[model samples]
Target: MSRQKMLARALIVFALLGACGTGARLAAAGEFVAEARTIAELKAVFGQVESRTVVPARARIGGTIREIGISEGREVKEGEVIARVVDDKLTFELNAADAKIAALQSQLDNARTEFDRAQQLLARGIASQSRLDQAKTQFDVIVSQVAAAQADKAVIEQRTREGAILAPATGRVLTVPVTLGSVVLAGEEIARIASGQYYLRLSLPERHATEIKEGGTVLIGQRGLSPVASGGSAAARQARIAKVYPEIADGRVIADVEVADIGDYFVNERTLVWIPVGERKVIAIPPAAVTTRHGVDYVRVATPDGPLDVAVVLGETFQDGGGPRLEILTGLRPGDRIVMPDVAP
Candidate 1:
C-alpha cells in the first residue's frame, strides 16, 4: 500500500478505540457502607518522571574515543569499563621517560665511580680536596636527575592507565553522547546514566509557592508503587512532597515527590500529579461497596425506600475508624448510605 493509505488507515483505527456507552447500572438492596469525607483538596498538575540520582560518565583526559562498550538504555555495573580513550601519544611519552631514566642511571653510576676515585686520591694526598668536592656534587646532581626522570615517568604511566572510562555507579545508561572516534576534552561528559531510583518532578505555579511544603500529600497516576494505598501497588498512588524549591523560576515552583516502585518507571516519563494544597468536605464510602466491571468503577447507594444502584465515579481511597474507604467523585450525595457488593437486598 502507499504511505498515504497506510496513514489514513492508522488514523481511522485510532478513531474507533474505546467505543462504548458510559452509563450507570441500577441494583437492589445491599450491605450498608460509609460516606465520603471532605478532605484536603488536591490540585492536579503535570509532572515528569526522573531518576533521583543522575550519574554522568566523563573523560579523564582529552583524547579521541577509541571504543564504546555500552549503548543508550543498557544497564551498567559500577566500576565497569564502558569506554576507552586513545592515548597513543602518552604511551610514546612514557617510553621516552623510561629511556631518559635509564640514561640518567648510567650517568649516575659513572659519576659515583669518579667521586670514589677522587675521594681516594684526596685521602692519599695526591688530589686536592676541591676535586673531591666537585666529584661528590656531580654524583649528587646525576642522582637527583634520575629521581626526577623516574617521577615524571610514573605520572605519565598513571595517566595512561586512566584511559579507560569506568562507570561510577550501577545504572541504566541514559545516553552515550560520544561515539567511536569522537574527540572529547578532559573532564568532558561522554555518557549520562540514571542511578535506578525515580521520582515525580512537579512544577507548581508560583502562586502556590507558600502552599507547597515538604511532607504535603500528592496523588500520582503512573506505574509502580502507589504512595497512599497500603500493600497492593495502584496506578494512582498517594505520594508526599519530598522537597519544595525555595526559589521560583519562570512563574513556577519546582518540587520533588518521592514515590515507591521507582524501578517501574523510566526516567523523564510524563505523568499527571495531584497535590492537596488544602482540605475540603468530600463524600466517601467503604471499598467493599465499590465494584468493577469491564474496567469501569461503580457503587450502590442505600435509600430509605430501597437499595438504589447508582453508578459512582471513584475518587481517592482514605481510611478512618471504618478502615479503608473510597472517595465518591460523582453519582452520590452526603447522608446516603452505601451497600457492599457482597450484601443482599
Candidate 2:
C-alpha cells in the first residue's frame, strides 16, 4: 500500500477507539435512587455547662479569718481544711477555765488536809463526829467543782479546734468569698465549691417538652459563641440526655445532658447543642453528588431520555455511618435515580 493510504487507515482506527471509550465511560457512571429515609429532626439550642452539686464551705465558729488556703479554680478534697478562724474571746475563756480549775485544786488540797485532821481528832476523841462529817463534805464539794472547771476547759478547746473551716465536698472551688483577717459569723460561707460530675443544662421551649425524654441522644457543637457542628468526630460530639424535669418554668422546659470528659469545662459556660425533637422522612444524599452554581444547588438525575440537571433546595448537613449527608428539601422524588459525579470517568 502507499504511505498516504496507510496513514488514513490508522486515523480511522483511532476514531473508532475514541467512540468505544465514550460508550464505556457512560456505562460506568454510578446511580443512586432517591428514597424516603427516616431521620431524627434535630433542634439546635444553647446548653449551659453546670455542676450537679454546688456546696459551700462555711465557718463553724464566729471569729476573724486568720488564714485562707484556697482560692477560686482550686481543686479540693472532702474534709480538707481551707481556712482558719480564731476568736480572741475563746482563748480568754479557756484561760479563765484553767485558772478556776487551778484555784479549785488548791482548795481541794486544803480541804483534804482539814478532813484528815478532823478524822484523826475524832478518832482521838478530841473532834466531834459532826465536825469530821462537815470536813468530808467540804472536800467532796471542792472535787466536784474541780471536775466541772476541767470540763468547761475541754469545751473551750473543742470550740477552738472548730475554728478551722473544712471543705464539704470534693470538687473545684468556684468562689472564695472570705479573705484572711475578714470577720465572719458562724455558718457563713467561706467558699463555694462545684461538686460531682459536670453536665450540660438545656432550656427549651415548652412546645417541645413532650419530645424531650431521658436517655435520648444529643449532638454537641464546637465550643464558641455560635455553636455549629464543625465536622468533628462522632465520638466527640455524642452525648446522652440524662434527665428531664417535669416542671416547666417561664415557658421553657429544662433538661440535663451527660457527656464524657466535661470535667474541665467551666460551670455555666454556654455551648451549642442539637437535640432530637422528632423524626421525619426526607431525601438525603452525599454532598459530592451535588453541584453549586450561582447560589443554587443542582443534582444530576438519570432520566429515560438522558441525564438532566435538577434544581434542589438544600437543608442542613447531618452525619451518619456512611459520612456527611445533605438534606434535599425539594425537587427530588422517591424512586428517582441520581447520577453520581465522582463515579464518572
Candidate 3:
C-alpha cells in the first residue's frame, strides 16, 4: 500500500476508540444519583467522664469508742461529734486536778488571812520583826502554789475536750470501721465519709489534655455505656473542670471536674464523667461516604447525572448518636442531594 493510505487507516482507528470511550463515560453518568444534605442541630465532641474513691475520716485520739452518732449512708454536718473516746485515765486526771485546785484555793484564803493578822500584829508592836517577815513569806509561798494548781487544771480541761471525736466536714457516712465499745488507737480510721460535693479525678492522654482548660465543661457517662444504643440520655450530665493536677499520672494529665449540683443523683461509690471541647452546627455525612486518596479526604456527592468527588473540610465527629456522621465544616449545604450506591441523584 502507499504511505498516505496507511496513515489514513491509522487515523480512522484512533477516532473509533475515542468515540467508544465517550459512550462508556456517558453510561456511567446515568447511574449516579443526588443526595440531599440535611442541616440538623449536632452536638460537639465532648470529653469523657471520670470518678474517684472517697476516703474515710480517722480518729484523733485513742480509746474505747463510746458512741457512734452516724449510721452508714446518713448525711452528717461539719463539726458533728461522730464518736466519743472513753479515756478513764483522762477523766481521773481531770478529777485530781480539780481537787488540787480546790485545796489551793483554801490555802490561798488562809495565806491572805495570815498576812492580814501579821500586819496588824506588827503595827501594834505585838509581833517581832522576824515573825512578821516569816508570816509574809508563808503568804507568798501559798499564793505561788495556788497559781501552779490553776495552770495544771487548765491543761487537763483542754485534753478532756479532745477526747470527743468530731466530724471533719459535711458529708455522707459510708462505713463505720470501729464498733461501739471497740478499742481504737489514736489516728485510726473510725469511719468513711463521702463528701456531698463530688469531684471527678481522671487522667487523659497528654495530647488531649492540652486542649482542656480549668473551668471548662465536662460530660459524664457510665463506663461501658454505649451512647448509640441508649440515645445518650445518661451521658448528658454537665460538669465543670475545677482543676488540672500539675503532674502527669500514668502518662496522662490528671484533671478534676466538679459535677454541677448533680451530686445527689450519683449515690453510687463510683461513676464516669466526660468533658467536651469546641462544637458547632454544620452539615454532616456518613463516614462511608468519606474516601481517602493519597492522604487527602474526599467525599462523593450526588450530582444530577452522577457522583462527583468533592474535597471536604472535616470537623469533630458526633459518634454518640445512632448514625456515625462527620461534621462538614465546609463544601456542603442543607437540602443538597447525595447519591447512594446504584442510585441516581
Better of 1 and 3 by lDDT: 1
For model 2, name the residue pairs that clash: none
Q: List, residue by residue over 13-90, the lDDT tens digit for candidate 1.
A: 775542111111233334554554667666667678888789899999888898899998899999999999987799
Number of the top candidate by lDDT?
A: 2
- Model 3: worst 10 consecutive residues (lDDT sum): 42-51
lDDT of 3 by residue, 1-345 (tens): 999999999999998787456434443542222233443232223333332445567776677888888888788887888888777788888889889888888888888888888889989999888888887898899889888888888887776677778777777787787788999888898887776455556567776766678988666654334565324533356667788987876778877777655453234434444455344456776665666778877766655764466787887555535466677777776765543332334
lDDT of 3: 0.67
| Candidate 3 residue 136 C-alpha distance from true site, Å | 2.2
Stretches of model 3 off by over 4 angstroms after superposition: 1-60, 192-196, 215-218, 222-240, 264-345
lDDT of 2 by residue, 20-129 (tens): 56434543678788877899988878889999899999999999999999988999999999999999999889989989998999999999999999999999999999
For model 3, state the Cα shift of residue 282 in Å: 10
**Order by lDDT, highest first:** 2, 1, 3
CA lDDT of every candidate: 0.78, 0.86, 0.67
Best candidate, TM-score = 2
